[model samples]
Target chain A: MDSNGFRPEHRFDVELVAVTKRYGGTVAVDGVSLRIPRATYCCLLGPSGCGKTSTLRMIAGHEVISEGDVLIHDVNVTDLPPVQRGTAMMFQSYALFPHLNCLDNVAFSLKARGVPKPERHRRARDYLARVHLQDYAERLPGQLSGGQQQRVALARALITEPRILLLDEPLSALDPFLRGQVREELKRLQRELGITFIHVTHSQDEAMALADLMVIMEAGRIRQAGPPREIFERPADAFVARFIGGHNILRDGAGTIAVRADRCRLGIPEAGPHIRGRVAAVEYQGSSVRVALAVDGGPPLSVVMPDDRFFAGPVQPGEEAALTWSTRDAHALPDPA
Target chain B: MIGGGARSRDPREKRPWTFYALATLMGVFLLFLYGPMFVIYLLSFQGPNGGVTFPMVGVSTVWFEDILKPGQMANIPVAFGRSILLAAIVSTITVLVSVAAGLGFRRRFRGSGILFYLAVASLVMPSLLVGFGIGLGFQLFGWKADLFSSALAAQLTWTLPFGLFAMFAVFNRFNRAYEEAATDLGANAWQRLRWVTLPILLPGILGVAMGAFTLSYDEYARTTLVAGNRNTLPLEIYALISSSTSPTLFAIGTLTTTVSFLVIGATLAFVFRLQRRRALARHG
Candidate 1:
């Protein structure tokens, strides 16, 4: 907690200006700048260790700036501690205080911020009820199931009504089935509350579903930042195109062209504008079956299609197939390599 | 299922020598144990030399009664009270400080790794060494090395590391999402620490508290070195033994041993009950 720091009055949205955090000589985040709109659900989408969480932490005042300023509500709170900044963070692992029961956990911030006991309970109960965890108020975090505990955590954060809510992989811990449900619930809550939510996740699907504004990052750099449609349509670079969706990554011309599995048309070469390949393997996954193909000497490519449609008839185990995709769908990637 | 019919490696080949050796050594050690303590307990009750003599020359409770004279009897309550008070203060402080440190270190920071290593190094230092250092340091500050204050500080030094490590393990296993969720819900640092961190760390804190209390209660080396002339039970027992008093230190030993075990057992039971409740809640 730095004492000699700037404290700007609240009015502006969250902004990151030329932020740099280096782990030793290796720069985890190098000169990243971003501005999130007020009450927007923004996501820092990236691969593992891409400084998404670091950037989020810096904004939340958990991590100190190496060379930049973090402005919240338009005020420069670069050196203010998290508490004094009136910001809240949802940790990647949910770092809930395990000692408190669900209700007490929800009421923790209220109590610390000097809300009286009766009012604290009222506010906590309201948030808990919002997450549909009112009954588990007396239960400790360990006592609740993973999903239930997450709800308690959500309630805890929402009760504070901070200027901006920071979430670090908040839904990564749930079972896949529950992850979907929670993700939907989270999306719903964000819309209803309309508070600024800055979420950090490695999952592209999660970002795609939840982000109103998505910033795709890799190796501490923002490859692309835009609305979901714009990012998906015109991914600013090759990395953004490759990371945001499953890309049939391939060398095209002097640069590179990435075609999504769904976009890659699996038809005959006679149809034109298609790549000829031999079927390597087929994986059935309920709704979709991923068909792996070896394209000449190039890397193996995966083409995903609806299971019901792709397996309508017997496609030979080692047979050859023609793959085609529109040039519009083929994102131009940079030759960074 | 298809690979299940393959011939498995023989079970005997999987056995390790260390387990067998440990089991055999433990069996032999237990066999040789209880002989000396059993003899002392028997002798403490024996009439005159090993004879089962009556009141004058036989088995009697007179020695037990003699062991508790009015003066000694009064000292018992006072000494017990003091031990309890010291243990309570030391253990409580140990738990609180260690929990705070443990929670702090649980989160990653610039110098967190260095701090963790230093804490581990401190924990590894011998209790006598720490006691000597504290005692010397306190005296340098012109502070009298008393039972209450000096012993409290020394015991904290000896016990806090264990408490911290125990709590570190708790935080490591705890769900980070709960903390995150609390944070998302608007918990500030202290609020999150109080509501989420402390609740999850409760078992480890209590477990360490009980262990620290018992350790401080029976502690000898550091307590002896730093307590100056303070007369704790262990120190008192040591005095009677070296004074050629023939006092029943064995009886005191047995009582202290039982007290330690009881405290440990009670803590374990409490933790177990919490675990069971947690299990039941999950299932329900």
Candidate 2:
């Protein structure tokens, strides 16, 4: 949504129309349909081998679309090669060319497109400067740190000025601190460029932190696709609810319901529809304490309470406790078909 | 405890007895490998009337000078040139063919197993037998086995397998992500291969090329049966051995060794320069 009152025209940047990818007999991506809005950060979040990468590859034209079409900027690009699809992919390894220097790696696409050497170098230098890597243009990939190499990859991918950028597990190789920093940097770059950035990641925190449009996939199909807050607050199925962690899927008498750990309070059994369970484990996280419990010899349930609140009423690992959440706080998940 | 602190963590501690034993073994092995070559180098400095079997009469360049004059039966310069040309051709063909085959073998295809085994079989088979087989094939086709034709083929049979195996090892360490990244960055097949694949694998390719050149340059057995009219340096050296008992043979050996050293040294220098340039790029 823009500042103007009227809805903006040409909102959709990339559209995947019933896209299916099959590797021989096995289907990697089964008829996934999605519309990524322009200039927004979209994350395809899923576990490994769940078609998240395959979906990203198909959008980037690296994978062939078996059943349907992919459209970028309203142009059908399903059969087109990656170079002609107006999309650039940043590989998981960062894939910086070992033989090429930073400037040369960034300038490679322009050189391939037959840009003159001086002009390509000038443009490449501009992009390197944009990534604040101007001083390291002559350095080989091996000489730079992992984060620096990632920036080089980003700069190289951005040099083509594609309408959409596809990244596969963009920050999986980074350490925790660097991952956070780079994730912020990626968001900032996407905001500045005002182009669609479709990032694929397995971490729910990464997706929630970076995405305006969050897509949760399972087993080659999209379980849910919406804003991050919406998906977190209301996952469409059991798979999404479980995958997006910190949620306890409890089976009451009626049906299964997903309730966030923080929302479930430790209380006496008579207060509400309480689950009586023994404390299995207690993890003292800095901001919150996660109390793991087993209810009626069923699946384990956990409740996250603020550290100060939890210590005020600390329960030992062997003690019995009753857990209850308000009915309104519980989000019902669709039954598995 | 049986060895009592042999694996001590302290760096300043004395090394275990196994170290001395291994070092002594390595020393003896090196001596066994290079002792004969050192004697040949020393005997090459023999006097004009010196015999091939050592105890030098005097140091002279007379035998070395004899190599320049074309003999009644053998010409050292011509054979040396032929050896160089043949090795160059073999090296070039070996590198090109092996790199292509190596890239092809990266994917699993039908008959790849058969092709791989055939290469290994060619490598382990007797060199004379391979030469005889190629020579026989040429004869069966009513063709004369020459230095550039049948001899080149026989040498290739030896070097290609080495080059291919080298390439296999090289490609094994190669990451396909680089090529995928190239494709993602808008490089076509030829561009990806030329810019990404070859450059990254340059060091290994150079190693293979050097190995092929050296192998072909010094090869004798395979070329012996197939070489019909012309003689390579090794064959000429063999003929010189049968005909005369002079120190000229030692001189020829010394000269060929010198040339080999020069070629290998130049290649090492080239590869070093390439590495150094890339390294220095970081500081720059």
Candidate 3:
């Protein structure tokens, strides 16, 4: 039993067992399985059309599954409707009802369940207060800013008191500054509520920041799924290394290896087991400099160095440089089938 | 006015000659459109002795009073009642069917394209041809054509296409995210439609209602071919025109225009209030 005295059977709040979603002749989600632990933040990270959104929809019961089953808190909920599956979804557009004010939007589910007006409004106001939007209760969704609308959507989804909360690209619509703020708010909310959150996002930064379990998907399949640090340090394949950014994937004599850009040392030709290449371009990134190098028989490579170190011995564009990394820093990647 | 032939000046700083030309053209076009209606309104108040074309001897409500009396040629009150009842029925059916069809068209069914084109063809086809075809079909089926049956069908052919197209435009602007959000919030299909879809679309539905009412109210050519025994208001007015030449016809025209104005104005006022409330909600 958990500290909150929740049953052991309800430990994993959501599980997808070889779930698949097909649209006519097209396969959107191909035989994907996932397990989301209770009170954890799981992010489905992928590029557009990578089935992350489809998988999320299927879990929320918004999309019909063509094959396999979905288990929510140990219950077979594959055939259940969205409301019956004990899950609520926060849409990408923040889809707050334009006609209703913020309070009514949050209280919508309660009203649908036939909660009386006074009780529903009080509960909705409490949720509004939780999101710091109590003053804007009577205002329409359009009156609020994008970030504000997102808060209302979050509160609306939370009011349903679902075992699992699904978020579809929650931060994709926010500005960069507001995205960070809302990301922090989401983490705080999940921690407080102690409910599983399955969020879908294409942004590597967002997934890395908010996810306890970061799932990388590619072409309707999961390429890798693990903690953000483990995935970043050692991606499962070439796609995850490239998709997550800041990793240089290369074909060495042993096999494919991914080395962190910051971990590679830039020096003369005699600097250990090094690959020599001509510097194609140099980008100054405030804290560090990324030097892009072109090798004769391989793809382009990059090495990041601290700004002070780069200034000490900077290589100009079109100059020849040798790239080397510590053997321990090189993480081997599995072959893509 | 800005300087003439000053091509080298900044465009924003100077008013172009084309602006004045377009403004004058619009003014003349509006005058041409409403000039005949203005004359009809003025002549409706003509004295009892005055002719339909003409110079008024004195102003009085004698012609307006004549609209109430049942004349020997045609009864105006019963025909007016029929026109109103028919238009109300048409408006209700048009709103319901058009909304349902509009939602259906969002999902591409097998024969949706053919159905869409057929609606368009019905819209552009001559009104007289549509009425005649329906009238002929009814006759062959051994059915008696009436205002509600035959004439209503003819009007539907005209108004349904317009409502459908208008709804297409409305539903285009509608976001699917709202419906999905409703479902996520535990709303059933009926609740989602009632609370989200219909409320968002009320303004557009009102527009369709107003258009259907006006179109059916003034329609004559289509009804003429199908209206079997009784006459609608427009048909009765036509009969009056052929039977007499006096200020009474002008008065009838003026009264019909007033009714049209009152209904259209009331609908527009309600729509305006709805829009203003939405705007106010946003600002507050």
Q: Top model by DockQ, which number? A: 3
Against the true structure, whose TM-score is highest?
Answer: 2
> Residue-wise lDDT of candidate 2 within B129-194, one digit each (tens)?
999999999999999989999999999999999999999999997888888888888888999999
Task: Give fnat for candidates 1, 2 and onward, in order.
Answer: 0.35, 0.51, 0.54
Residue-wise C-alpha lDDT for candidate 1, range B56-161, written one tens digit per residue: 3455455556556675433554566678788888898888788778767866899988877876777678878888888899889998899988878777777877
For candidate 1 chain B, which ten residues in a row score worst on lDDT? B48-57
In angstroms and one decimal each, the interface RMSD of every candidate reads 4.8, 4.3, 3.3
B-chain TM-score for every candidate: 0.78, 0.92, 0.92
In order, the Cα lDDT scores of the candidates are 0.75, 0.89, 0.89
Whose DockQ is higher: candidate 2's or candidate 3's?
Answer: 3
Query: Which lDDT tens digits does candidate 3 get at residues A1-337?
Result: 5553435677578888998889999998999988888788999999999999999999988888999999988778899889888899999888888788999999999988989999999999999999999999998886788889899999999999988999999998888999999999899889999889999999999999999999999889998999999999988888899999998887677888899999998886563557889999999999999999899988788999999999999889988888988778889988666
| Candidate 2 Cα misplacement greater than 4 A, ranges | A1-11, A294-296, B1-27, B46-66, B69-74, B276-284
Question: What is the alpha-carbon lDDT of model 2 when measured against the actual structure?
Answer: 0.89
lDDT of 1 by residue, A1-337 (tens): 2253433444446888899997778888899998887678999999889998889988887677888888887678888777666678776555556455778778877777688999999889899998888887898776777888778767777777776888889888888999999999888888887778899888889999999999998889888898998888767766777677667776655467777887776776563357789889888888888888888888788788887879775465589887777767777767666
Off by over 4 Å in 1: A1-12, A84-86, A251-255, A285-289, A305-314, A326-329, B1-21, B31-35, B38-60, B70-232, B235-239, B242-249, B262-284
Task: List model 3 lDDT by residue over B1-284, tens digit each.
Answer: 12344668565797879989999999999999999999999999998788787788799898889877666534887889899999999998999999999999999999999999998899889889989999999999999999999999999999899999999998997889889889888899999999999998888899999999989998988999999898899999898888888888888889989999999999999988776556523212
Candidate 1 TM-score to native: 0.77
Model 2's CAPRI class?
acceptable
